[model samples]
Target: MDQAAAGMQGAHRAPVCYRHPDRETGVRCTRCERPICPECMVSASVGFQCPACVRGGSDTGPAPAASRPRTIAGGTVTADPRLLTKVLIGVNLAVFLAQLAVGSSLTDRFELIGQAQFSLFSPVQGVAEGQYYRLLTAMFLHSPTNYTHILFNMLSLWWIGGPLEAALGRARYLALYFVSGLAGSALTYMVADPRLPSLGASGAIFGLFGATGVLMRRLNYDLRPLVALLVINLIITFTPGFNISWEAHIGGLVAGVAVGYAMVHAPRERRTVIQYGACAVVLAVVVVLTLVRTAQLT
Candidate 1:
């Protein structure tokens, strides 16, 4: 100690705070053992520590947890509002189960057979009647005989619905979904055989794919994966034995892309207004086409 003091006297030097280098300090951090000044000191287990050492943590420590995740009334987590997606999946499952209960009768009634003779379940035999609801209901129906149809559709729903719903929010997402389906049905109603029935959410799912691509492009993300997906699905749809509805896919994809584009291009200042307008335009076109097509379905 005397020798050190003699050396210090010769040079006029002492240990200094690591953080505040201008201030001379006799104290060192307990954790890092770095010299520290009063201003830089933080209370520690054994002794005072430098502020940096406290921030860095010691062998036995990590900073305390930050504030807890927030929740809303009814214990809903406010961080993500994916409620719409869940409701959609639930409804699809419920409808699928109902199909199972009704057996062969379900597909016969709900499948889109555009100008087929109508009953209570499908009450418009001719375009003269307003059985336009058939176009919408057809989206919810799937082949009761082919389990894979509903399986793949629902899986796609669970996979894609969450992200899309989150991006678009509840109302817009629902609009996209129903409109996409209606577009597919509208096209199917016009182009497909009135005798050959079609069913499934593939059309709506295709709409999501198109919407995803447009939104991605707007957000400046890579779109090759989606493009590849579109190609693959189209190939599957057209493959001879697949017996998929290419008409629905085309209609839904077109509608979804249109909606997605408008949503993407909308000005941030009035995004909601423009989005609603875009949806209205898309729906108006689909409805008018349906009316015109139904009128011609003689």
Candidate 2:
């Protein structure tokens, strides 16, 4: 017979209980291989056990032990609603609709309502002036004259933003979007015209593209489609009569790449410091360049 069977047979042969070796017990504890008298035994799911063993086992071990709570990254986790993308889209659409409500022709409306040279689009100039907010506000404003401006940007966001938002969570995604947008605007201000008003989410969208590229590379995902799409869009940006901000597009794209490299490609343990520092450095350089260009223009 097997050892377990032999043990059981020997246990049955003894009139004394298995647990209470000193006493002539008549019952066995089902789980722990112990004996008890009839007065100490209790019925359980599997068989009979000493009342004390059952109670103590339930408290001390797996018998009725508290379940282990599940963990994500070694802590209890909660789901995060994707709020940043929705808020960004809402703000852009709201601004577009507001532009429509104003009584201006399409190109003129976009120039005025979107963002343009302070003299052309607004009544102010210089960074210190209240018009300085235009550096940021412009990103939320799109060309009301062209449907493609909004369509392409929003589509890019849908495709690229969803995955990034899922990976980075809402806060980091939002920060990347705004910082990239500002980087794009700074590039345009330096290269194009600071006094000239320009506005669109294309810069931020380009940043998303950059981030997507990094994500693909790090995750070993297929990148051919993304590269193809980027090439096609850039071609469209440079096409004659497109009236697109190629400068902003390039700037945001570069910023996104830099940020993504720091965030997604860096070793996990070093990412937090490296990512924040890289983004900050990029923003500072853009700001300084914009300031110098603006000074020269004035």
Candidate 1 C-alpha lDDT tens digits along 198-241:
88898898999998887666544557977887798888999999
Full-model lDDT for every candidate: 0.71, 0.66
Best by TM-score: 1
Q: What is the lDDT of residue 261 in candidate 1?
A: 74
Q: Compared with the true structure, what per-residue lDDT tens digits does model 2 show for residues 1-298?
A: 6999999987776456453355454346777767554333444544455534655754233333332211111111114334567677778888788877774443333331222334555344444332455667778777777878888788778777865665555556776888888898888877874445677898999999998788667544568999999999899989999778898899999999888777654444555677677778888987797667656655
Q: Each model's TM-score, in the order given? A: 0.69, 0.67
As for candidate 1, its clashing pairs are none
Top candidate on lDDT is 1
Worst 10 residues of 1 by lDDT: 67-76
